[model samples]
Target: MTDYKLTEYSHKAGCGCKIAPADLEKILSQRSGTSFKELLVGNNSNDDAAVWDLGTGMSVINTVDFFMPIVNDAYDFGRIASANAISDIYAMGGKPIFANALLGWPMETLPLELAGKVMDGARKICEDAGIPIAGGHSIDSKEPLFGLTVTGLVRTENLKRNNTPEIGDVLILTKQLGTGILGTAIKRKAAKEEHAKAAIDSMCKLNSVGAALSQITEVHALTDVTGFGLLGHLMELCSNQVSAEIVWSQVPSFPFLDEYLALNIMPDNTTRNWNSHELKVDGLIDLKAFQVLNDPQTSGGLLISVAPSKVNEVMALLNADGLNHAAIIGAILPKQSKTVLIK
Candidate 1:
């Protein structure tokens, strides 16, 4: 077996490599397009996945996501990437039926055996999700990358959106934050074993709970926090109808995140994330808090907005599903010039 560190081969870890929000928007803005009435959800909304109405009371959800390794283990990297890709479907309140593997390899650098292990790891996750890898395409590339293009089905009425939060809605986050910070620590060999394990465990978790939450009409808006971080994703929920007020102390985060932050260990994407939308943030009370909020997350968690009356029910469902760290982090308020207000 070849002993290789996957993270060493990649310039950026996981979603940390995503194009900065500002740059992406600029690229997307240049394209003028004809609208399709059947396209329920598309780029205009910055939604997790594109939904096409099937016109039979069901909709087809499609999304593709791929990224470079964030961990040293080939198997773990595969699992995380697969989970991250499939999360978009769950975020749209759909059940994934099948997926097509997406792989890129540095043929001269990494051994094929390690790549096979990556596929095996992704296969295990597909099995757990009760889906099959129907087909895929591969390419020779500079770095080893893996993910999936998932297809899902959802009742039209059950489809959740990232831009539908209403005033008085409560925000519930399904997992703790700080994966980006921990990932940076891992690359620098500065993280404790327990902290690394925590990050990997969180990334490996599926966000299928978002689909389940769709059954409750009170779930006004749903999105999985990924490369953009919690605040970035929350801003999507706020849209134009309302703004968010987050109680900084109530947000769920890794136990030793402060230790990593204190050492100045942070992802490169953190600054890009803040700069993209900092103009719309209010009450920037703590610098560390601001950085943590902007830290890119890989396969992080679901950020849900639910009607205030259903907060208890939503929390109960999350806890019953074993999301113990899930928390009611904030609430929606009347639209303000600022997108988010942190206390």
Candidate 2:
């Protein structure tokens, strides 16, 4: 049975319901920008968070992420949403110390206790992260929305960015993909109970283990794969100096991917992700293989680039901590016009 008495709504759910890619592109193209440098990190590349240099060893990483209900249960939705927001801080190799709530509630429709459960869920997760939910603002809205604005601290030298993948660095993903697809399936009432549970577990899982890897000093770059999917995140890592080759068979995913594909439960973001790639994806072993690359993830795992020699050691550490999903999905290739090829 569902947990909330949510009314019929007009808009789509979560940030996943964002404007279509082509329309959004046209809008962003007309916007002018400067003084972005003051922001240590911003949404320029659709990254998970923003950062600002605070001078000395201190820097403030600020990110505000909010979305509608991804799960049927109000408390679980809140927990997953909070975990998704806090992940941005961990992605930057920083520890979150504080967070403020961002909410859009329709109290006239949904029960207040349901909202209380949301706060309780957020509070529990914050307690685990050792961060306080200081305070926040809310407004009545047509649809439900909730998330957090988090603040974290990282040393200058330890700040990790998505754009810094070094040539020859191996790509490591800490969590499996296909959550967005499965979530969509849940909304459509086509998802199996076990599959939906697995996807929810992945989305709610924290990236703190990956963040702790910064102590190794050899992990080159770090970023969480969320709305952008794996391919989009890889493109953000690629530049004139770096190219990549990801093994399709080697990429980890939820066991139900083939089953879900058979059901045609794919989300709208999947095609949008594939269309974002101008360069052709070569060595396409299977169409479904390529399609998985565009499967939008929610609160997905950290995609890390590390020195080849250090790969085994890092994997050993992650595995020792029971992070078996942390595996080398691909390796950085020599500079090429096409940033990625799936084999």
Candidate 3:
């Protein structure tokens, strides 16, 4: 067994062991009276990255993401986690400029060598993204934890917003769904090496492709799917004037995911997300049908909304560059009372 530091054990890791959904709801609801500022992108909309206008030509994009070891390999885990965090920058049509490490290590249980591997993995990803690791802070805890606080630069003209999904837009998702379910399976030893490897590769893949998306003026809005899952993120895109229809069959999914679901290995968050949006999705489709679709993602792909006429060109660009998993998943429609529909 490993050795690690001791802390007052209320929870195992930082943010990984998030407070229960019910508790979080109650807490957030109690603070609904807070006011918003012109430049502040507050929690009200569940935005992926916060934007701060610096001045004339540029803006600052800030986001922080952290989680526990979804896989056992320290180096691989760090690479995936760092990629996941940096994805937010690209999702918002920004270039990551620098990153600061966020870590919680069990100094008494886990060896420093393992922690070093984690940083090494993160460093490699930073190198790939053309970003720098400026500096960071760490804590001693009962469980190993790792992630990054990334800052990116966005020109005023290039920034993407999650709330700007337009009615004439088409939806595209860059990678397959089911990482969360597959990850749960791995933790339970119910998945094979191939399945685990697929999930790892997807999680470690960067969103530099999304930067190309910014050049397409018709690409209206974007966000990266992670902990909350696709349905959760889609609900945030819905507005009184615009809604979305998801072609469930067109969505890319993992190879053995159907088999895993057949074996009942879906993660609990999948259902939690559905229940949270049950009101918005009531008659749009059978809620019971999507336990696999709504599964939480770890470093998932960009979910972009582009002008319907531009879909082919976008797909062609992604394909020519070897982004084989990229596909047009749905279209934005004139808003209906239901907000979202799955066909």
Most lDDT-accurate candidate: 1
lDDT of each: 0.91, 0.78, 0.78
For model 1, residues 1-343, the per-residue Cα lDDT tens digits are: 7689898899999889899888998989965599999999887779999999999999999999999998989999989999999999999999999999999999999999889989988998888788999999999999989999999999999999999988998999999999999999988889899889999999998888877898999898899999998888887888766899999999999989888888889999999999999999998779888878999999989999899889888888899888999998999999888999999
Candidates by lDDT, descending order: 1, 2, 3
Q: TM-score winner among the candidates?
A: 1
* TM-score attained by model 3: 0.90
Clashing pairs in 3: 3-108, 3-109, 3-110, 4-108, 4-109, 5-108
Summing lDDT over every window of 10 consecutive residues in candidate 1, give the lowest-scoring window.
Answer: 232-241
Deviation in Å, model 2, residue 53 alpha carbon: 1.8
Clashes of 1: 0
lDDT of 2: 0.78
- Candidate 1's displacement at residue 179, Å, is 0.7
**What TM-score number comes out for model 2?**
0.92
Report the error of model 2 at residue 175, Å: 0.5
TM-score of each: 0.98, 0.92, 0.90
